[model samples]
Target: GNRAEQKEDLRQLVGLTAGSDDKALLADITLRRASMYLATADYEQAVKQAQQATALVATHDNKTLEARAYRIWGRAQWQQGRANAAKPLLQRALRLATAAKDVLEQAQNYYDLGQIAFLNNQFSEAQQLLHQAIDLFKVEDDKRNMIRCLDNLGSIAILSESNFEAALTYFQDSFRMCQSIHWPYGETYVLYHLGNCYFEIGDFAQSQETLGKTLTLTRLLGDRAAEANALDTLGLAYQFDGQLEQARAKFEEALAIHDSLNDRRGKAYVQTHLGILLSNLEEIEQAGIYLYDALSARSDSGAKETTIDTEAALAWLDMARGDSDFAQERAQEIAAWLQENGTAGVELPFQVFWQCYTVLKLTGAAEEAQSLLQLAYTQLMARTQKIQDEDLRAHYLESVVYHRQIIEAFEATTR
Candidate 1:
């Protein structure tokens, strides 16, 4: 059943069992309700229900059920942006699953932990954990979760900055697996990933086409959140391709949907995109409003990483307005913040590094800009080295705009 129907069914089940003496049945029903809440994006309610289920199961000897309760609770916590709290709960759940010899549950804990690791920017750890989950899922022939593993593996591959080719391979592998399993949800999501991949690889036409297909599938599945996500992404494709009006329309549409759902995070993302578009169009003051709103929204959501991304966009606007001092100050502050926080190996896809480098250079901070350029080139080459195919590697180095920019900046500055 769809997420909405599943939620309603689980709610009815809870009501039906309200006076039951069977603690186990009630606990199970409540846990299912928690899972439904999660599926419907009611993170707080999911956490509360999962906690209730855990308490109800505590007096029983059902280790598996207790583990499921913990797992659901952990997932709800992660969705609620409490990943630190989610980690230990997931670990406890994993231990229980292992003790109970429940392979699937163990695999699930690993997958969730991997996701948390990814969110925490521990890319290597995330990769290793996801690999473990994939192996266990293979043992159970769980094609559905196997697709998820592949999708996350793709994300891990690309999150290092470049390696879009590697990500593309994994996403395509997942798309094929989804097709084989007739999993519409996975298929739709993977297509959305592919559309994003195409956009990042400089295939705007293909990006638009793929995302258009994603939009159709999302609508057919009645997944409004996913539809809004697609619209935002498609809007990005248009914005980056210089179709400003179309991009604005798409962003406005996505923002309206997000507002209706009270999805602050989603709205922040679209706002950032619109702000960038507006800045590009030289709507300086109004662009600043959108960008600052996005920054505040993301910061309030505890999305530190993407908040830095919005900060970078704000720097872009500062640059556009010839406010070199302000741009330089933001760049330096953020650069220092990343260093202080020990957030390594994360070149935010928002071009934060490039933006910082440009502002520093323009503002006569040559030493700092040169240092950043050298580091960026080093990272770019590191990503380039991973592409084993000569043609693809050459294309990435030569054709990808940012890659080329870093290389040129390095050469111009150093020589």
Candidate 2:
């Protein structure tokens, strides 16, 4: 907590110093402070500083500095949930960098584009962009941003497509690069990502072990946000491993940190996950209340995707309460929203399938239920079929149970 305050103070000092300085120095200081903010995950402040830096460059007329400033500014904007605002700025930066023949700056611009694509859940596009950035980085001998790009690619592979093995391979390569460069923060970042891949693959044991180390390292380094993230991931592993008590503890701790730090999105995420665990324990009313709160929080935080998920949870709760009509209504609402908005990745599809399955089962439409199940299974398998192996195959078993439950329910209804 004390360290967090101290870091904020440093951030303010840097911002003030950069704003008061002349063009060249201001640009340099702003970029440096933007890097600091990125490390601290204070993306809003990073964007502010980057914008300030870009404003200064209009007076100085330095294309290279302007390009770099725009790239960083665009990244910060994307991270701050303004991807549309980021797009044109990043495109301008890329064009400027290319025109200036600044290979490294051009590579960094590509790296930022990859990040934007990843955030928008464009996995294949992100991979292609990141690979291009990596090649550019190698040509320019820029190992640092190259490794960062790799980590981003790894994250997309894990979360967007559930390609855990590919994600792990990327993390391993990133870890090797971080080790070769003796980058402490980079090492922790890679470890955290590796843990996520392991978690997604159902290797809770490895996830727990790696994330435990990451938590310790982040805490020792006084990185509050990173520590909170690691704790949250650890909590998730516990949740999936059926360690409800431990999961609750970890989640409570993480929720406290997010609340204290005023991270609304983080709070919403933990609240939703904690609500799920509570529901699993048959604490339905309490879970419903929490899930509703989580839904509102997610909406306020502009986490529209998570808001949809919490809606699905509410639908599930309604079904569990024997309120089939309400559940069906909510499920239809979600499905309509998903179709209109065209969700970027698999999560939206997953939520849609669950809702459709629930509605079909509740209405005693056995044929439609089986059809939806087949559709979901076919999509999931098609997306991940090539990626699964013996060790990772069990991860898909959850989907199987979901299908089985609907079939069983439909059979019971017919009887």
User: What's the residue-level lDDT of 61 in candidate 2?
Assistant: 63
Query: Over the full model, what C-alpha lDDT does candidate 2 score relative to the true structure?
Result: 0.75
lDDT of 2 at 313: 75
What's the distance in Å from true for residue 176, model 2? Answer: 2.2
Best by TM-score: 1
| Deviation in Å, model 1, residue 278 alpha carbon | 1.9
Q: How high is the lDDT of residue 210 in model 1?
A: 96
Tell me which residue pairs clash in candidate 2: none
Query: What lDDT score belongs to each candidate, Candidate 1 first?
Result: 0.81, 0.75
Alpha-carbon TM-score of each model against the true structure: 0.85, 0.81
Root-mean-square deviation (CA) per prediction? 3.3, 4.5
Worst 10 residues of 2 by lDDT: 397-406
Clashing pairs in 1: none
lDDT of 1 by residue, 117-220 (tens): 88778888998999999999999999999999999888777775457878999999999998888888888889998888777665677889999999988877
Off by over 4 Å in 2: 1-21, 159-162, 260-262, 282-290, 293-307, 320-322, 333-344, 348-365, 394-415
Report the alpha-carbon TM-score of model 2 versus the true structure.
Answer: 0.81
